[model samples]
Target: MFSPFERMVAGRYLRARKAEGFVSVIAGFSFAGIMLGVATLIIVMSVMNGFRQELVTRILGLNGHINVYSLSAPLEDYSIMKLQIGDVPGVTSVSGIIESQALMTINGYSTGVMVRGMTRDDLMKKPVLSDHFIEGEPADFVGYSAAIGRLMSEKLNLKIGSTFTLVSPKAKVTPFGGMPSSRTFTVAMIFDVGMYEYDSNFIFVPLDAAQAFYQMGKAVSSLEIVTKNPQHLNTVKRDISLITDGVAGVYDWRDNNSSFLNALQVERNVMFLILTMIILVAAFNVISSMIMLVKDKGRDIAIMRTMGATRRSMMKIFILTGASIGVVGTFVGTALGIAFALNIESIRQFLQGLTGTELFSEEIYFLSKLPAVIDWNEVIAVIAMAFTLSILATLYPAWRAARLDPVEALRYE
Candidate 1:
C-alpha cells in the first residue's frame, strides 16, 4: 500500500514538465508499444480460434463424427448395420453413404466431383445437408433428384429443375470391353455449407438411384455416423467394433483428419509464442524507461530522502509511477482489441471495398468470411501476463532509486 505522500510524488513524477520532455517521449513510446503489442496478440489469437472453430463446425456438420467402412468388401445389408450402429450407447444416427467419384457435364462444361447417395430419411440425419438450402427445400429431395452445392451450381450455370449428366467409370462390361455409365439427374436442391471445397465438389442423390447408377446392388461405400460426444469417440468406436464383429473398420473424425487438425493446433501455438515476444519487447522498453527515469531523478530521490522519506517509500513511489503506464496501456489495449476483433469481418469488407479487391478469399482460406472469436480465458491470460511483466519491469529501477545515497546524489548534482 502506498502512503499519500508516496502516491503524490509518484503522480507528480508521471506528469511531464517542459524540462522532462525527452523522458515523457520515451514513456509515451513504451506505452504505445505495450498497447499495440497486446492488441495485436488478442486480435490474431481471436481470429485463429474462430477459424479453427468454424472449420470444425462445418466439417463435422457435413461429415459426421465417425466413419465405418467394410474392411474386406463394400458394406452390404447397410440398413442393418445402420440400425445396429444407432443402437450403440453413444451413437446418435448412422447414415449409409454410397460414394463414387464421377464427372458431371452440362452444355460442354464438366468437372469431377464426389457423388454421395443417401436416402431421404438418412439425409435428414445430417444437419448440414438437411438444413442448408439456398435454392430448393427438403421436400424436393425425393425421386431421382440430386442436391448440389452453391459453387457448383454457379460454375455449371445450374438452377432448380436444371438437369446434369453424371458419368461414372463403373459399368457392366460385355465381350467388347467396358462402357462408362452415365445418368441425367435434375438439381432438386442447392445448398451452401460455407466451405469453398465442400460447396463446390459434392453432389447428393437418392440411395436407390445411386445404387442403380453405380451397379452397387444393395451395398454402400461406408456408414457415416454421429455421436453424443465426438471428443470421447474411442469408447464408442470400440463398442461399434464389437457390434460390427470385424466386418467393418471404424474411425473417428480425429483419426480421419488428424494431420489437418494437428497442423491447425501447431500453427496456433506458434502464433501465440511469436506474438508473446511483442509484449516481452514492450516490457523491456518499460524496464529501460524506468531505469532512465530513476537515473535522471537521482537528486530528487536524494532530496525526498532528506525530507524524512523512507527507502521503502521511495521504492513504492517509483514502482507506482512505472506501473501506471503498463496498467493503463493494458486496459486500453484490451478494450481496443476486443472491439476490433468483434468488427474484424466488417472492417475487412470495408477495406476490400475501398481497395476494389477481395480481402478474404474463399478459395485460399476455405471460408467465405473472416472470423474472430474472443475466448475470455485467453483474454484473461493475456492481461495477467502483461500485468505481471509490467510489475516486474519496474522492480530493478525502483530498487536503484531506493538505494540512492543523499550525499553521493547531491554532491554529483
Candidate 2:
C-alpha cells in the first residue's frame, strides 16, 4: 500500500535532506572499500593467470609437447622410432635429443647447465629455438660449438666466439678406482627466451657433439615429440606408448611442471578468497547504515503498521535499501576491476617510473618486469562473490525492521 507514512520514510531517506552526514560518510566509505577490493582481486588473479600462461608457453615451446624416454638405457635406433612415431595420429615431428648435465666455466665463472643436442636440420623445425637467437648463430657443432641461453652467458661472462669449457663427468676408469670424471667445450651463440630457469640453464648443441661429449655411442637420451595440436599431448603420448611397446616412458609437459603449476593455481585462489573478504566487510557497512535508518524512522514505521502495512512489507523496504547500496557498490567495483586488469601493464610501468624502481627486479623476482594476463573467469567470480556478500549483509537489518513492535515504536512519539 502507498501509505503517507511509508512514502514519507522512503522519500526522506532517498532525498537525504534529513539524512545524517555520518550515514552518508559511511555509505561513501563502503562504496570505496568495495571498489578497491574488487579491483585488487581482479588485477591479482589476472596477473597470476598471465604468469601461468607464460610459463606454459615458454616451457612447452622450448621443451616439446611430449617427451619419450627409456628408463633402462638410452634409446637405440631413434631414427627408426622417429619414423614410426611420426606415422601416428597427432604426431607432427619426432626429433632425437641427447641431453646431459654438466658444469660450464667462462672467465673463471662456473655454472651448472643442461646440454641438449639436436641436429641442425631438426633444430630448424623447432620454433622455440629458432625464435630466440640473440647472438651469433645456432648450433653448428663442427669443432666444439654450442648455443647458450642469454642469462647463462651473462652469468658466466660469455659472448659469441668465447671459448667456454663444458666439463661433463666422464666414465674413464683409473687404477685407484672406477669413478666418473669430467671434459670441456666452447660457447658459439646466445639465445634469450625470457624465462629465467630455461635461459639460465640450457645449452644447445649438435646431437653428435653431445653424444660424443657424454660418451654415449649409437644411443639417444630422449625423443622430443612435437604434436600438430599441443592440446592433444596426452593422446600423442598414448599413441607413442602403444607403438614403442611400453619400453619407453612418455611424459607430457603437464607431468614435468605439475608441482609448480599447482602451486601457482593454489596461490591465486587463496589470494582471491582473502581479498574478497574485504568486500564482504565493506558490505557490512550497508547493513549498519540500514539498521540505523530503520531506527530513525521508527515513528513512521509505527504509523505504517497502524495503517495495516504488513511486517513482510516493512522487511522488503529495508532489504531494498540494503540491496540498492550493494547494487551500486558492485557496479562501481566491477567497472574499476576490469579497467585495472586490462591496464595493469601500463600501471606497473607508470609506478616503476614514478618510484624509479622496478616492480619485478631481476635480482629479486627473476623477471625484469611484471607479467599479467587477465582471466575473465576470475573477474566474474569476484563480482559474484561481492554481490552475494552484499545481499547477505542486508538480512540482519531487514529482520530487525520486520520485528519492530508498532505500539512500542510509537509510544515515545
Candidate 3:
C-alpha cells in the first residue's frame, strides 16, 4: 500500500533534474539490461521448444512410436504380433515393416539409402509422407514401383517412371564364391518430408515387393506400432511387451533419438542460466544508481526528516522509484519477446534475403524453417525473477536514506 505522498515523491525523483542526469542515465541502462535479458531468454527458450516439438512431429510422423524387432531372426510371425499389438488400448495401428541399408545408383551417381517396405495403405497413414507429394500420385505407389524423397530424386536425377538400381551387399553363395544381389525398381512416388535426413536418405516400396527384393519370404525385419500419443507410451509399451514376449527396441521416439533431444534440453537450460545473468547485472545497476541518488539527495532527506516525514515513507518512496524501472522493463520485454517469437520465421527469411546468406540451414538444423513456440509460464517466471531482484537492489539505499541523522546531515550541508 504505497501512499499518495510516497508515490508523488517517487515520481518527482524519477523525473531527474539537470544535475541528476548521471543517475538517470544509470537507471536507463538498468532498464535496458533487464528488458534485453528477458527478451533474449524468452526468444531462445521458445525456439528450442519449437525445435524439439517439430523434430518429434516429423520423426514420429515418418517412423513408428514403438519399434519391435525380432532379436534372433527376422520376424516370421509378424501378422500375429501385429494383431496382438493392435489390440493394445492406446495403440493406433501396427504394421509389418522391413528396413535395410543399400546403395542406390542412377545417372552415374550413387548414394546410400534406407529402404523401407510398407504397404500403400500403411504409408498413407503417415501424414508427413502421404501429404508431402512434391511430384507423385497415390495411385502410382502400388505394384513394383517405389517412392523416393525429393532430395534423393533431385540428387540422382530420378522421376516417376524412371528406374534406379538397388545393390545389396548381402551376396548369395554361388559357384563363383558369392554374387551380390541387385535389382532395378521404378520410381512411382516422390515426397518432401521437410527433414534433410529423411528427405535425402529414405526410399519406400510396397511390402510384397520389398519382401521379394530382400529375399525374406513371409518375414519382416520389424513391427512398427503407432500410439495415440508418443509422450504417454509407457503403458502402451507395457501392453506391447505382453505381446512381444519382452524385447522392444526404440519403444518410443524419445528412445530412438535420445541424445539429440537431450542435447537440446541441456542447451536450453544452460542458455537460460547464462542469460539470466543479464538481468542480475541490471539489478546491480539499480542498486548503484539508487545509492548515488540517495547520496545526491542527502540534504533533501535531512529536510524531509526534519519536516516529520516517517522513515517508512522514505523507504517506500525509494522502493517505488527503483521498482518502476524493473516492472516496466519486464512488461515491455515480455511483449517484445512474444512478438519476435511469433514472427521469427518471417524475420529469419527477411534477414536472409537482405543479407544474402543462409541463416538457418536444413542440412545442419534438420528442419527447413526456423520455429518458435512461447511458453507463458516461463515468461511469468522471468518477469517475477527480474522484479524481485530489482526490488531487493533498492533496499540498502532506501534503508540508508531512512536512517539518516537529521542534525548530523545538516552540519555537513
- Name the best candidate (by lDDT): 1
- Give per-model TM-scores: 0.97, 0.88, 0.97
> Which regions of candidate 2 are displaced past 4 Å?
1-19, 139-143, 173-186, 304-313, 363-367
Sorted on lDDT, best first, the list reads 1, 3, 2
Per-residue accuracy of model 2 over 1-413 as CA lDDT, tens digit each: 44565555554664454347766677677777877888777777877888878777777787878888897989977787789999989877888898888887766777778888888877667666677787776544455788887888777777777787777766656898765545456677677777777778888888888877887887899999888887667677777889777678888888988898898889987987798788878887877777777777788778878998899878777766666677677788788777877787788889988999867765455454467787777667777888888778888887888899999997877
Off by over 4 Å in 1: none
**TM-score, prediction 2:** 0.88
Instruction: Give lDDT per model, in order.
Output: 0.89, 0.77, 0.88
> Which pairs of residues collide in candidate 3?
none
lDDT of 1 by residue, 297-405 (tens): 9989999899999999999998999899999989999999999999999999899989999988899999988999999999999999999999999999999999999
In model 3, what is the error at residue 116, expressed in angstroms?
0.9
Number of colliding residue pairs in model 3: 0
